[model samples]
Target: VGHLAVQIARARGAYVVATVSPGKLDFLRELGADEVIDYTKGDFTDKVRDIDLVLDPMGGDHAQRSLKVLRRGGVLVSLLDVGDNTRTQAGARDIRVERMSVVPDREGLVELARLIDANKLAVHVAKSFPLDQAGAAHAFLATKPIGKVVLSL
Candidate 1:
């Protein structure tokens, strides 16, 4: 999700700041992230500020820190739970906090397909496993590969 978010934001002409582990810095840069931070080294809030929107896949304390970098009236969209304190802080700062969940929509999928057909979007597949190896694929996913893991029939 984070990887695709970076690409989608860039496609929309956003100046993207992406945080990843040390090994994935170059990967994010290749994905057109304007700034890439190694989250393992230190806090990303130390390096980024005054952003318009923050797309956070890692919630909890990371979500709280994300709020500090957003400009007033900016949006923080989290794919996971960002506790009450984060919401309170966002309200205080005039920032909007949104929790997002995936909902299937045919229209959205069609648009995504159009983007792919036009070479405006790319899907990063880190690994693929045969149907017989579904368990192995799940285990590999647990290792948190850099991109999507596909189960091939």
Candidate 2:
């Protein structure tokens, strides 16, 4: 999802900055990230500032500190969880906070397909698992791959 977001943001002419672990720094740059920050070395919020949008997956600490980086009207989206503490800050900062629950949207799917066909987007299936071994798929997911682990049913 982060990879897709990076591509989409860059395609729309946004300067994409990714905060990644050390191992992913080069890979993210190869995918056209304008700047890559090694998140393990220092706090990303301390390093990044005046940002427009943040797509946060690890919502606990990241969702809390990320407000500091926003340039007044910037928004932070939490994909996993949203706590009341985070909500209060968003109101205080006067910036929008969205808790996104990804559901099927026909228009979005059509646009994604168009982007894929136009070679503006690529989906990386890191590993494939059979439908019967759903438990194995879940185990593989425990490894925390940056790319998709697809189920080939």
TM-score of each: 0.93, 0.91
Error of 1 at 84 (Å): 1.0
Point to the candidate with the largest lDDT: 1
Taken over the whole model, the C-alpha lDDT of each candidate is: 0.90, 0.85
RMSD to native, candidate 2:
1.5
Segments in model 2 whose C-alpha atoms lie over 4 Å from true places: none
Which ranges of candidate 1 are over 4 A from the true structure?
none
What are the per-residue Cα lDDT tens digits for candidate 2 across 1-153?
888888878777889999988777887888789999998998887887899988888898778888888878789888978678987887888878988788889998988888788787887777899999889989999987767888887
Q: Weakest 10 consecutive residues, lDDT, candidate 2?
A: 117-126
TM-score of 1: 0.93
